[model samples]
Target: MAARMKRRDFIRRTALVGAGLLILRDPKSAWSYQANNRLNIAAIGAGGQGGGLVNIFAGMGENIVALCDVDDRRAAETYKRFPNAKRYKDFRRMLDELANSIDAVTVATPDHTHAVASIAAMKLGKHVYCEKPLTWCIGEARAMRKAAIEHKVITQMGNQGTASDGLRQGVEIVRAGVLGQVREVHVWSNRPVWPQGVDRPKDTPPIPPDLDWDLWLGPAPYRPYHPAYLPFVWRGWCDFGTGALGDMGCHTLNLPVMALKLHRAIAEGKTVVVEAEHSGCNGESYPKWSIVRYHFPARAGMAPLTLVWYDGGKKPPQEVLSLIPGEVPGSGCLIVGEKGMLYAPGDYATRWQLLPADQFRDFRPPAPFLPRSPGHHREWVLACKGENITPMSNFVDYAAYLTEIVLLGNLAIRLGGRIEWDAATARVRGRPEAEPLVHRPYRKGWTL
Candidate 1:
């Protein structure tokens, strides 16, 4: 038999062909795939949320060409379901071996690893769908956005709520001035169900044979294997996860961010000041309970706004909670406007009501301006198939901006002072000490 071609050589030889096939194809005919025009897709972190994503895309008829996970135990079911698909513990090896074959990739890795996996795929001109809040730090978020644009790949963040008609309608109403000059917003979550605000565990257990402990660590600093940080409890840890704000902010803050056009405001040189008061952080993990406030200057012909985020059972003042009929939701968002408040009483912002029901009992929503999404994952897949469409949470258009804003709050929490953000330069003013946290150092062999 002839020798097999090396992965690097194959990638270099077919780079242009791959780019032309995926990126420079005829736009009008991109989405014209027949019922059986299945895409060859791969998934990273194929367990937990990743497993659900694998099933969803597979259910949509795409081919599961390959799957990668650091923990084989967690990904056993997915592996069993797609036995024909190749498997690997290291994503780098998978991408190397299948570089020219994958049409798209879905990333459900831990927060710290998101940028590395997604950027690697995008650099090869593959479309990507990544879980929120997009990246572990502000710098990675920016880099992901830039890579998506440079590679000209279709991209979407897995906020999921962006696909809801109710969420879209709420965004339209708020933008159409139905909320009447909103200036205050409150978003809360019942999170940190995992342990936080505590010191790191001292015991170092033997690494599980089913787990590649170093690969699982990825870009995070060296830490011994521990059950305390795995199997769905890493969100509260600062090193591996992004805490509650990073976990839930992408979903809870989606509507308000879109409604207020905050992204555009930030782009146009407006200052976004952020500060936080928490239950006290020990530096190893996020605080158990905390509230963060972001102040945005008036922009785009709108009033200045204050967005306060609460987590760990803390909530807005009772006066704000009184607007709801019953007890305030364990997690919700309330936008206080001059005329009335727009209350979305859940994490997804899927259902919302105008507060002071008596005053707006006869109110009517403005005509819809935003086009509705064909399911969120479907949106990304269709776009990847060359549809003349853009996913609602496309990295270039929305996700990156949203992630940047959400992660900035973490900076405030870490530095224990107000963050005067200069969006143009992506820096915190007068806080050189906080700059390292904005873009953290990675272990050797990792590059964004």
Candidate 2:
């Protein structure tokens, strides 16, 4: 296997919890490695971003016990880096065989498989660090939060910006009324830097011998193997990926969503209106460009907000960009409050500026109330070791709900129209046709 390998590398509609917030820290895990203040970690997808995650965890001095990936070529780099780690073509097998040896797992798989893998690990009491836009569908997002809460496990979603001091400060600044009564938020992304706005290719190319075709299509309904769907291009595919909004919404919208308490607002209204306008729509892929609008009712002593998301060559109006000086960046967020807007000029929201530079020339940001992160992944590792620190993007408090909100845009895109979401029931309001997109049907072997 080493010689052949290339180099370098869920639908359960449960009652959605309202504002899924629970205790952030619990030193209750009984993993055997706890005695030594280390965790036996497993990487479910150890190549590309996944490989990067494995490298980070390993560098944190945790044990990398096993590795799983469907494509050997994609995983070659991780294999070279951790030759001793047991390898498997499927995560289910890896978890079953090494469950006892593993104390925690990091799931860097595609968005579709996130909930299943993370839930499976959590069911066995394994701490999990899954990548962002937590799950493919809203129901799965709800299930993820419920599972994490039930297991009482440490969990963090991989939106690295949540750990940045600047983002934390931005959140604090908004909450402190520095951006008083933020009623409008405009966020745009330079994404779908992948294939999109097209029908599925008719050709059935031979699956590479290095790839386990069936395993790679986990949970999602089966489709003929195509190169356009793999090696990171999957972001544009309707069946497998969540499109540009899903790809970048979690990051670009992170600041406004957190600062404005958008997730919590979902619980306040089942009629939260979501609508989208795009270049075009298709059954198999996302549009080339899209503008998704979400209507959020008043919550947390804040006013109502209409958060607008743009991607695939779309951006906020020139009026919104006028506040920021110089050339418009490819991706950024603008939070428009009564006082002034706070502009965070990157995906992570790690750097932000209060707009109308002259208005607050001497404006002072509020003192930080939120605890600083030890670094994105480090928070998870520390929490796994029973440290006092808790990751900001833990599934219970943040990730799952944020993911649900982000994926809602896809539902609107799928319908090419507005849909009201009933957060309480975990379904779309009076839209049975939209139900499938909320809780998707999986292939025979897959179970959510």
Candidate 3:
């Protein structure tokens, strides 16, 4: 006689047996079984980057069940593609009405609305895939991490490079101590391809007929509709987006952040001081060019380090760029270590090389430590299905902490001085007046 299984194991085995029986009875039923397993996914902000995400997930075999966007005109292509999916202008209404139907949601709205939408979905027990910087401010990032923990839902931040094997290898190499006792990191970006350091547009254009202006302003203070803030120029604005650092830092900083374990250090109550020197910020948009520096104390047996960020056509000093073999790319990350330097060119850190090539021509990278991702979207989808896999950019593990660090640069930009940070208390020491910028006031009817 077969050994009796525990009740829990028996029930699980019985369910698997029943499912196998269905598959064996009819060949076509196997396909139907797959269809049933697909997640009922919804998308908020179904235009621009959101539309691209909707199609990617749908192509991956998830059922697109709903789409919400404030501008009908901008989302027309996606609407036409997923006509079967229910549509709405407001995410709040869509989530309320389809609370029972949605298994997961993808939030690709403006940075300011990311936390609100994601928190709402997580609260309803729906899995969430949110685009990066994850949140517009430090407080929202903390709230997002908390909500994900409290609700026990699958969550991924859309730092797609986290899926790259090259990036993972780079991270492994860094942590393996190839560059012994690293002390400095410099990251640069050529952003603000849009305008910055400028006054708000004086023209208040007529709100487009297909656009819901009130819904577009969700959680942000009221401002008249202007074309300048639409169709992707919002990155430069203070209220709607996180400017260049918030825009590209997640991608550029991912490699170093993962390898150095900076997030874990911050969580363990390490001191981080932030200061900035910029061309000049007018409180309306980011400066045309600026550099921000972060000072981190020693943690986890690693030496203390300084991270410097540049954006809006700014870059590391020429003496630093000379370390590279040829002309430096428009965007890149350079880590200076005591033994050698690791230079990764491009926003994703997908490709890299050790500097002073002759010194380490035959350097072999360490064996891979991080589990290779199947793909960024697939990782999240599989996690949502209760698979054992964990997405690398999940809110609690990575994105929230990254967002907090990225936004700290913004706070320094606004305050125009070095601000001592207390990570445990989430306070700016000796600058109570700057506290409000850490957590901005949301407009009426929205809460995180």
Tens digit per residue, CA lDDT, model 3, 303-327: 8999999998889988999899988
Model 3 misplaced stretches (Cα beyond 4 Å): 1-36
Q: 1 or 3, which is superior by TM-score?
A: 1
* Candidate 2 steric clashes: 2
Model 3 lDDT-worst window of ten: 18-27
Candidate 2 per-residue C-alpha lDDT over 1-448 given as tens digits, one digit per residue, 9 for 90 to 100: 1112121101112321222344453336622233445568889899899999998888888778899999999999899999999999889988888876888898988888888899999998788999988999988988898888787788998889888899988988888888779788998888989989999999999999999988889988888898988989888898888999998888888878887888886655445789999988877899999999999888778898899999987888877777788787888988999988888887999898888889989988877777777899988877666555567788877888789889989999998778888887877877899888988887887885
TM-score of each: 0.93, 0.93, 0.92
Lowest summed lDDT over 10 consecutive residues: which window, candidate 1?
Answer: 1-10
RMSD of 2: 6.3
What is the Cα-based lDDT of residue 211 in candidate 3?
92
**What is candidate 1's lDDT per residue for 338-426, written digit by digit as tens?**
98889999899889999789988999888776778899999888877755556788787678889988998888998897889998888
- Residue clash pairs of candidate 1: 30-386, 31-386
